[model samples]
Target chain A: MKDRITGLFYILAVILLTTIHSIELYIGFFVLLSVLSGKDFIPVMKKTFVAVALFNGVITLAYILIKGFDYGYIALINLRVIDMTFMTFLFVRRVNLFRLFEFSSILTYLLVISYSQILLFKRYYTEFILALKSRSIKTPGLAERYGFLRSATGFFIEKSVKNSSEISLAMKSRGFFMD
Target chain B: MIELKDVSFSYQGRKAVENITFSVQKGEKVVILGINGSGKSTILKIINALLFPQEGTYRYRGEIITPKKMKDREFVRKFRKEVVLLFQNPDTMIFNPTVFDEIAFGLRQLGEKDIKEKVHYWADKLGIFHLLDRSPFELSGGEKQKVCLAALLSLEPEVLLLDEPTANLDPRSTGWLIDFLYQLDITVVTTTHNLGIALELGERGLVLSENHRLIYDGNLSEFLKDREKLLEANLIHIHRHRHDDMEHRHYHIHDDFS
Candidate 1:
């Protein structure tokens, strides 16, 4: 019951953040979140910044260039995104999404399988970079870099196709898609 | 030719390696033994200089190796050429368009001439001569592994660090690899969780316990003989079964029936 309530609460917060444009409320809420984050304040903030910095920077720059200088408008746009992101992060950290989504069995099943795949591929990608670093006798040239990128992309594409079919077969075998 | 003093490393807030200290003399074969996440691969990374030690010093050929030291172009060229690492996944090590180019990459990078001759030499030696023109991406797992090995061996590295080299190999490929590795004169450090093959990989073993600490570093045969050390490293397990309707329990080493 608590998980479902928390899930709805986050959804409501997102709706409010998007629909309402009160800058003062956004600022206050962000401050409250930072304080609530407490020991994780720095790490959480860092992740939020990394996730949004480039994106927000480009939007802010484009807006200023197109419409001239406007501090209030810029602040509103940036704060809205930052707040939304922070709330999402905090909610994920505190709430178990699987439990929250228990109302839908299929959704929960998809999450379980995809989450595991996400983790595995993330490590595989890291290993690719480390492998290149380990084997490069000197700085990689342009041709080498291009080769690495091509091969990495090809590998992922092949893996995705193979894994999807394999997963589909497993799901079918388990009567997941039975008519 | 390689030394690590009080080496320790961590990922995020969790410890991966804790106060690991060891040295490998020229031409020494050492096997790093640990279960998954027990810091076997992390130790290999430190030795290969892919990951630097957070709380200790790594010295190669009497020079303290640091990220700063790796910045020197001359040193990087020398160090990388001298020490090479084969990742657990062969796909990660290979990215070239063709097997020939892949094997020739390191030599070409170092401005070495006769790349074709060297590439062919190692390819023939590793039994991948037939796959020279074929794309490495399309090869079998064992073939890809051989291609990656040929690529590294073509560089003629003195120290070879293999991370779970046989984790993806079949029985025949694994057997062939063991035989192939036995003939190599270079210093080899292999990491594996399989206690059965540890003896075949090297005479010496460095075992890491679950807590990410080095529990034992000595003769592997001696290590195998000691059941206490095997249990401490989680390399052995207690199994219960019934023989003719009689229930009994006995400890068994992983992948080793005897």
Candidate 2:
């Protein structure tokens, strides 16, 4: 029940923030990443932050000089860089790299956060089911329950296979597992 | 062969592992034994290229192992496919939804085209074919461990680095794991607190001390038989039955820092 509730909260948070603006949404997203991956990658995060800060400053300055900061597009791009840099730094200071990347593969990190979200949901449902079973609820229909289970299972299996292949390809492209 | 020379790693100016040097020849089953906080897992991490040493060198197959070489994409992809590390926690390693995909993960990481056939072969070998469609997270600890083993073994890695693989496993599961490991021809480096499994499966043992330093490296039986020495190293105790006296001789674990 707690996990399911928390999962719902996570979805709501994402929805709420993303609706505000791209910059606010980016900040929220990266903050979550920092909290998740800040530990093991602290040193890496520090280095990445410094590099990204320099990169962001340069890019912002160039945009201001050429196109001016009056337009929102440049600010959005700058906001993204700033958000990523801040999150990377926080992540370096806080989370272990191994723990941060614990659930990711090269591909999983890219092309959709759905894989992680679905995993989180599956775990939520499993806990919910166990709790429900513990309460000794009267079964209305065995076939209906079985059908629900089968569909839930199919959903998980489909996502997992697709995500694994996607992550493998992404890792390969990023020079992971390329011996 | 894999070799680490003068490796040192420090976090926030505090050393985790320092001046460590070790070598494992091809096909050698080396067991690393140590008490908690002894840097045993840290050593494995360095070898797997998960952590870079602040000093010294790590060489694999006579060539230096570096991020530059690893960044080549081809080298790392090949290395990971050939030498895989099995983490202590199966929950961490078994990410796929089912046993089949979980076992196929490492193989697929290596770009194996015929994944279905390879997955079947490994599943059958590990005796988990019936559980193929079952969710990996739902499996028991022993089953999860088997799934993890099947996943790594399917890759056919030449060097298998296991960090306390048998830890928290049931006696039956531990026995099965020991038997499976003994049958493998690949080089196996395992860090374990289980003396029984170590004695049965490992021919050589290396003891890591509280200082995160190597204390002893030699024969498993001979090492286990020395109660006084082992106790000093904070290692597990093992009992031997004397045929002449019909009495059990206990080799007590040593307590370090005395």
Candidate 3:
């Protein structure tokens, strides 16, 4: 499917799944979508299941204590949430976000920038952690931990500001604001 | 044409560049050579109008480029369209999903017709045509640099400002870029800590001291031959070594220290 069409379909599916109260229908739809999505379905379903179980477990327990064991309502709510989450994962995996938002160039640009920045942040964080691990011969003490945290926070803040400014200039140099 | 007179800039009360004066005629190529943190990139930013000089004037053609002048949409549009800067980090410069889209970005922003053709042309020129459909984030540093170069070059800007273009590139890619840049007829100003690239990029060189002063501006060949000037700029260090067979004297760059 075209990315834009897939995005639109995903949105519609989310709305439909949320409104529908039938646990059987939601389960049927989830199974169908899972099968259609192929290889990524299992992992997506696993993640959605864990997330939904943890979140709804608390709420479902409280409800059961207050009222009674309502298997139908609890099952329906949990299934709906799982279906929505799975659909979102499927959409993300299927669609090329940059291409999906190409209709709005500015939006596409912003998405690309944000995505790159997120990757950069992740890389920086990982490097810091790795460096800390490599340098330490023993467990870090309280003072050492505090120092590392302070330094890491300062570095992250400075890097974020620097990256944003530099990226902004790069965009401007390319006539990104000309339109 | 571009000119800067008595230009100075500071970041958080710390000076980056000071009392800088230089000019480039139409179609002239100039290389700014300096050690790291010597404000070479800062000068490029000022030229691109990305940063306003805190003192003195920066002019393109004849008119002064002030913050007020840049506020004028028309002036900014014209300036941005005419002068383009390739940042030091290609990773920061690339923010598109695919190499093709990244190269086509500037053309699209400028409302250029036949963006595909321009993108393909530059991509082919840069030898990144095969990677066109691939994600820029997945590319190697050299490939990313080529993609960024293609993107900026596709716009056909009159003035090209490159900040440490060869910094992250491998030797082969660096050679390719040098060869490619040597053929361009545009007004080019590039910054580099590598004296070799500076020498290759242009005959004229501007050396910024560690303290952010313009210490040298003239023939690059002459400037490079002067060991004192090079040492003063912190570009190299003289090291003496003795082997079992013989003694040798050489100058080596302290890359990490710099």
User: lDDT winner among the candidates?
Assistant: 1
Candidate that would win on DockQ: 1
Model 2, span A1-179: residue lDDT tens? 44345445545754554355576567667666666664645665567667777777788788889987755776677666555555445433543443444455743454345556666767546533432221111331454355346645654676578777886787689786785
- Candidate 1 regions with alpha-carbon error over 4 angstroms: A1-6, A13-94, A102-105, A171-179, B241-248, B256-258
True contacts kept of each: 0.92, 0.00, 0.00
TM-score of candidate 2 relative to the true fold:
0.58
Tens-place lDDT per residue, model 2, B143-185, is 8878878887777788888888877687777778889899999
* Interface root-mean-square deviation, each candidate: 0.7, 16.1, 17.5
DockQ of each: 0.75, 0.03, 0.02
lDDT of 1 by residue, A1-179 (tens): 89899888888989988997788999998998889888877888888999999999999999999998899899999999999898888887888889987889999999998888988899999999999998887779898999999999888888989999999999999999964
Worst 10 residues of 1 chain B by lDDT: B249-258
Where does model 2 sit among the CAPRI classes? incorrect
Q: How much is the lDDT of residue B17 in candidate 3?
A: 98
The candidates, ranked best first by DockQ, are 1, 2, 3
lDDT of 3 by residue, B21-99 (tens): 9999988889999988899988887887767899989999998988798777677667776888887666555545678
Quote the chain B TM-score of every prediction: 0.97, 0.88, 0.94
Error of 1 at A138 (Å): 2.7
Interface RMSD of 3: 17.5
Expressed as tens digits, the lDDT of each residue in B161-183 for candidate 1 is 99898889988899999999999
Structural RMSD, model 1? 3.7
